[model samples]
Target: MDDITRDLVTLRDYWRYAISRFNKADLSYGHGTSTAGDDAAFLLLDSLDLPIDALDPFLDARLLPSERKLLAERIETRVTTRKPSAYLTGRSYIQGVRFHVDERVIVPRSHIGEILFREYLGELGSSFLPDPMAVESAVDICTGSGCLAVLAAKFFPQAEVDAVDLSGDALEVAKLNLAEHEVEQQVSLHEGDLFAPLAGRTYDLIITNPPYVDHEALDGYPPEYRAEPRLAHDGGVDGLDLVRRILDEAAAHLNPGGGMICEIGSGREILEEEYPHLDFVWLETASSQDAVFWLSAEALGVE
Candidate 1:
């Protein structure tokens, strides 16, 4: 770190050094980034309060002594502590939408964001959703930092969103994000189990990325994943406990023509085996084919 302070003057220099250290440390990623290079760049840009995506412009810019010290500490901490970079910086992004985060919530990286983008803009437009404009109400179960709730509010600007979470700590973090995105008026936050806080409150659409990591997997998770709240990841014996609850109740909460989209991690097989009577429309994203699923109220057998 002392050598880095004297030698690394530009963001580019720090970027190279950070990547080297991150790769050598064999740190696990996937909190808004997937690789060593991306992780290094995200943390470096975030530490300097620079545009996370606009790194090229500032690569050559020199850093102050204060800035260098902060970067050094952050870089070392990321390698040694195994705490996710998002927790270190207190921020994360889903499809370029930023949200504040800490140990209180899992860093927002659900495939639902990709699907929501498609529902409104991609070729799949109106496939998962017939008309975004017609949607008057929606809910985001396991809202965490409320990233999906914010996206839902944007995608369906006319809809009122109710976001639910069992953790008051997570809901508190979500409060900051709701205010940060200025969707405070459109999205309401509730603290309770999935759909528990929204009893009798039906909606035109429902979205959830609940805790779906089974206990077996949770035990083998590296320090980076384990650092997060166990309540956010433990999905019971099969990682589908919360998902099943949402699936069982979502149709009742949705309008007859409405639908639900859920991210179940890798539980597609488990779900199919359990619910053989229903067809789960698996949605494909850049990284995975079975990570998310969609089913309309009619499919869920709602009248």
Candidate 2:
């Protein structure tokens, strides 16, 4: 082992090293973290086989020689390959729930998961749906990694969830996560474009975090983003191509009082301009505002 590796005896030392490497490499984040320090913590804690949330207890703990070597290798891989930390760990969490992720699917990081767990439709109030438990069925379109689908099932235990994705490979990853969360019995996986596979099926609620990254933005995304599946990020010219189709067809698949919630990732302006006649209730989370919207069946002009 190198002298530098030997000197990384404490967890804090390794963490500092990881952060330095991440920053120097100019890595792009947002799969689960927004900064190099946060990403470094995840990678370092995961490499040590320690619970990521329980860092306070082990921050100064000393690392074994073998552990130090493993962490060094992982840090090197992180800097050299520029893969997202989630991909490096092969796992990700949404609202404390764990899911499997790989190149087959985009890393699961959506504010919709937070909104679902909160069980409160922001700005729309009770008129949208007074009680989340009343939702008998839900569908998660473009359900990459099935994180949102699993979250929906957990949030509304009585609701049966259908997770749809255009890529079969992504569905395979979702299936693993569904089983991991033990929601397979309640959540069904479908492989097809948007609502095509659903045919005559409708739901009490339909949620999606589709590919809303515009072509221009996608072209400029950092290497970390380029590592993910292209089909999961490209949203065409204005980033509203798929969103337009979804809005056009969502009303038909929604129950009378049902609603549609979606994450547009900064496409709110385009959405408002394109559908000026509709009233969209923009929802806010702790980290974001105006990135997600909810529209009731009535607002969507569906009976």
Candidate 3:
């Protein structure tokens, strides 16, 4: 057990050492895939009543008995159980934003996080929505952890965000995250399949990172994904089962110039084949994640 005091240099070295060992040891079954080291570090910091930013300094110093015990137990758990660090700590970050996550809700790792962080989508359909507060009313359908809804509020300060999810458990996690960011007042939580609870309500923006993983792909999802709620990851046969339904009725829920932003996973190929005549701007992002489409109410045949 390395002594971890308030020394910055030593702390950073120790943290890196632990991270490297965890990575090499394959302590987590989901290791090499998720940020297991970060998870372990977070757990340690949390147990010591220390802040994450203080990690560099603490690792350089010698560890107190309590701290050593805490880390030892955590390391043992990680090495022996192959459990994901997020599940151990019960939280995750997306786009530098902290989001409360757990088995109830899938961890927030969507590529859309990059778009939101870059403010790309905010401008994509800006022409369609001329109102300065056009995004004042937005919906994050199939919102898990309410990360997207919270980001919408953060980006569009005036927006009243609605986050809907079919799973009560998922909603609970989303609620916690929303409240954590102190955006509870700016966001509303609804429990039901997409759009079921919206009724007559309409929004200027509808952003979603819905279940777009096809049944086949879903079945083969890594163990980490399997641990997440199926309702949050399964998108049916072609991966657009729910997406098609959302698009079919989405126009009705969008204000005249409003649009919906959706991440279609690998369904891009399917969407292109199915809606060749429709005009949807497929926004590109880092990596193979290339199926996000923005559609206006008009595009959906909504009058």
Candidate 4:
């Protein structure tokens, strides 16, 4: 073992080393983390079973010899495999809530998560939907890892949640998360193409973060992204194959006074140009602006 791995004495030492190794590898990020430093911190914390966000407080704390060995292997594995720290650690978090994750599903990093917790929870005073307690039914389509569905259930406790995903394997991962959150009673999992299995069912709220990456982007995905299942990110030639379907069919599946919030990454301009007649209300979050949109049943022409 190297001197650092053999003699490193503190979490701070491991933290700095992880950051350097990650940066040296030029590893691609985006699955819940955006930079080498962020990935390093998460990997170290998760491996040690410590609080993920409470790192600085523990940085100067001494590390056990076994902890040092574990961190060393993990830091090297991260650089060598280029796997997202979420997958490496078998966990991911959104809005302070943790979810079990794996290669079966894409890492949960939707901006809709912020809107659900911030705006819908009234931190920013949501203007699109009714109060959480007033909502009776909701759906999370393309519910990879079931992160958003869990968030929806937690944010709107009284509402019944339906989480749908096209990949049965992805649904398996979602199942773990739903159960982990103790929302199996509140959130139902369905394996099928979007809305196909929800026939004759309408929801008061809908939140979807579907596969919206264009073909060009998919073809060029770095190792980190390519590690995830293709079904979670492939949005077809123009990246709107499923989004178009949702826009076309959502009106019929929405109850009176209901609305849908969806994440489309970079499809804002194309969506605006293609569906100019529909009044789409773009939403902004702490890290994203206009990447998500809100559509109401009335605007969708509920029949």
**Best-fitting candidate, scored by lDDT:** 1
Give Cα-based local distance difference scores for all models: 0.90, 0.87, 0.72, 0.88
TM-score of each: 0.96, 0.94, 0.82, 0.96
Residue 200 of model 2 has an lDDT of: 90
Regions of candidate 3 where Cα sits further than 4 Å from its true position: 1-59, 120-132
Task: Report clash pairs, candidate 4.
Answer: none
Clashing pairs in 2: none
lDDT of 1 at 299: 90
255: Cα error in model 4, Å: 0.6
Which digits, one per residue and each the tens of the lDDT, describe model 1 over residues 1-303?
A: 788899999889889999999999999987879899999999999888888999899999999999998999999999999999999999888877788999999988988898777668866566556598889999999998889999989988899999999999999999999899899999999999888888899998898999998889988998899899999999999899889888888877988888888899998888999999887899998899999988888899877
Give the per-residue lDDT digits (tens) of candidate 2, residues 190-294.
999999999899899999999999989998988999999999998998888899999999988998888999999898888899899889999888888998999
Q: Worst ten-residue run, lDDT, model 3?
A: 2-11
Better of 3 and 4 by lDDT: 4
TM-score pick, better of 3 and 4: 4
